[model samples]
Target: MKNNSAMTKIPKGYTTITPWIISRNTARLIDFMKKTFDGEEIARLYNEDGSVGHAEIRIGDAVVMMFDAKKEWPDTPAFLRLYVEDGDAAFRRALQEGATTMTEMTDMFFG
Candidate 1:
């Protein structure tokens, strides 16, 4: 029986689950995302040192948050699965944006 309606507002175009990336250079990472996935910057919160404390970007319908790595919270790599309209085109765009190819684009059966 606790009433807690006064909370931070979640931005538009975001779901309950969001992926956050902790990068050494948040601006560089944002730029990469823009070039690679056609991501658009939705919101950003900057730190005193001019580094990004928190930032959000939208790629297609997926919105992801990112921030600079801090001593208290270290970097942690994560795996992201994006379902794009054209897998081959998206893969090519990623390569063009300096992503190393782990595997070639291929179709797989889930059923």
Candidate 2:
């Protein structure tokens, strides 16, 4: 019998380092993910206070899960840099969706 664990073939449709973001605006983020990347909501959990506890959305072959950060989890926040097909378009979309522009989208040598 062969040891399948030692096989070198890369698994098909496998993604790496899927991040689970924590944010107070989970519902807004979910909407942003949907509009920005055509994401679909998979699962969601809400608290009695109507705050989103957790949620999952599928965006462009990637799954992004998120939850509302409580006072206990002060370090949790969603900070992401997305490399998309069109930076300008994405930036504009983000701005239109109420994302404060921290840095105006500009072309850099490395990027």
Candidate 3:
């Protein structure tokens, strides 16, 4: 008998994107993603008061994890590492659209 299975095609490197939530505006972040990156919400967990406890979004072929800040994790800032065709252009657009700059776009030895 011949084994015939549909092989799954995968990207060269696939990774999940997780962003920390510190601002009081998790929902606004969701909206920003949709507007900025055309992200679609996949799953969302919310508090009783409608605050987002967690959320998953799919932007293009990548998945992004997001969540609201909890009292327990008071100091963790949202961190995201995204790979795009043009990092400089993306960085500029993000800045033009009001994203708070933690670091300016620079080519590093690691990147």
lDDT of each: 0.82, 0.77, 0.69
**Which ranges of candidate 3 are over 4 A from the true structure?**
1-23, 71-73, 109-111
- Considering TM-score, where higher is better, how would the candidates rank from best to worst? 1, 2, 3
Ranked by TM-score, the better of candidates 2 and 3 is: 2
TM-score of each prediction: 0.78, 0.73, 0.63
Tell me the TM-score of model 3.
0.63
How do the residues 23-100 of candidate 3 rate in per-residue lDDT, one tens digit apiece? 556777777777667678887888897778788777777777677776666666656676767777777767666788
Range of the 10 consecutive residues with the lowest summed lDDT in candidate 3: 5-14
For candidate 2, the lDDT comes to 0.77
Q: How displaced is residue 56 in candidate 1, in Å?
A: 0.3
Candidate 1: regions farther than 4 A off: 1-11, 71-74
Candidates 1 and 2, the one with greater lDDT: 1
Model 1 Cα lDDT, one tens digit per residue, 1-111? 775453346556776678999888888888888977788998889999898999999988889899998867766886788877777887887888778888777778941
Residue 92 local lDDT, model 2: 80
